[model samples]
Target: MTRPLRLHYAPDNASLCVRLALEELGLAYDSVLVDRRAKAQKSSAYLAMNPNGLIPVLEIPQGPMFETGAILLWLSDTYGGLMPAPDDPARAHAVQWLFWLANTLHPTARMLFYPDQYCDGDAEGLRRTTRQRLSHQLGLLEQASHADWIDADGASAQGCYLGPLLRWFALYGGATDWFALQRWPRLLAFAERAELQSAARKAASAEGLGPKPFSAPIHCHPPEGSAV
Candidate 1:
């Protein structure tokens, strides 16, 4: 029998991209909320699943998987959809964007969102510097936005990863004003179009997130029990 898939997640975390990917693939899975306020993610049991103590730990039939990019890649490679063919020339480009999102953009956004975690002194300074770096990165993305999606293809995990980050920039990084969408018209258009995607909408709705997902008020204490 095919064992049920299980996802250990916390609200408003990076795990969201994994959920969006699963929804896009039309895959059924269970969601186990890891209470951040309660430190459930740091518990021994959770750590056993993901020693990194991350919010997203996908338990597949064979074993558990950690890291947002790795899980997304596994799902795409295993499920045979939402990614370019392994041998396709565009596959390299797609993979490059995915890595860039995971490594460069996501980490920089984290510095902006949780400055204190990254630095002990001058948190605001760290945020300002990170925000500036993020702006440069966004400008690069805007310049590269000649395509409808980050990938040459229609929609992939890359778009799923980027849309939320853009929203986060508006909510946490003061980008809504200083780095307004008007400054990056192409990225704004891409985000708007990505938000309308069925999978994106469904995933956000499932997480109790609103249309302006990152703008939504995060619940420190979510409802008790599994959200599946």
Candidate 2:
């Protein structure tokens, strides 16, 4: 067998998606932790790998893979599982959600939680605006989640898959409530299942390495959206 892949990641940020994807794919990979709080991501060594200094860099046999969503697509395609079979409608559906998580939901969520980190403008003003935007997008997320999708219990449900965001919301407070999440048991169940996976739990444990105060914490529209 070939040697395992090498993965450098920071668990406290959006890198969790790639971590979970690797686990689901049963890929053997080594982990390198980046200290987000210390701004280690901006270091020259890391910048050489990814100018953006983002986490969850996968050093595949062919080359380095950056960006979580892109990595997810590559892993699913390269390994063949966790997503719908190639060209299936569900495959498109999976990519739809993945990109929504990547482009719209994830960016919005980060802006809300860490506006100060990204912006040097009025921090309080950014926080207020971010909260409002977050609330509105969350409303959209609840609505879409309640429509229809695969559920945790293997039953059909209209709105589900908001479980990951619900957990984050529950930890942070504000946003919506638990009833909305329960509307899709399988989605919640899926989150729970994925959460319990060894790699995911391990990643969670690694988050503690960030500064002591590092508690971690998205949205869509008239066109409908998902949170990261």
Best by lDDT: 1
Candidate lDDT values, in order:
0.75, 0.55
lDDT of 2 by residue, 1-228 (tens): 566787776543455566656665677788776766667778998787788877758888877778877877787778876566676766666667667767876676667556678789876677667666666665565456423343433211111123334445434423333224445444444555544445545544544421111112222111111121
Error of 2 at 118 (Å): 5.3
Per residue, candidate 1 scores C-alpha lDDT tens digits across 1-228 of 998789888766778888888888889999988877778888999999999887789999889999998888888998967678899777887788888899999999888877888898998888888878988998898887333355333558787788777766776654345557668877766766666678877776777666755323233223443322
Give the per-residue Cα lDDT of candidate 1 at 72.
86
Top-TM-score candidate index: 1
lDDT of 2 at 218: 22
Candidate 2 off by > 4 Å? 1-3, 117-120, 145-150, 153-190, 197-199, 205-228
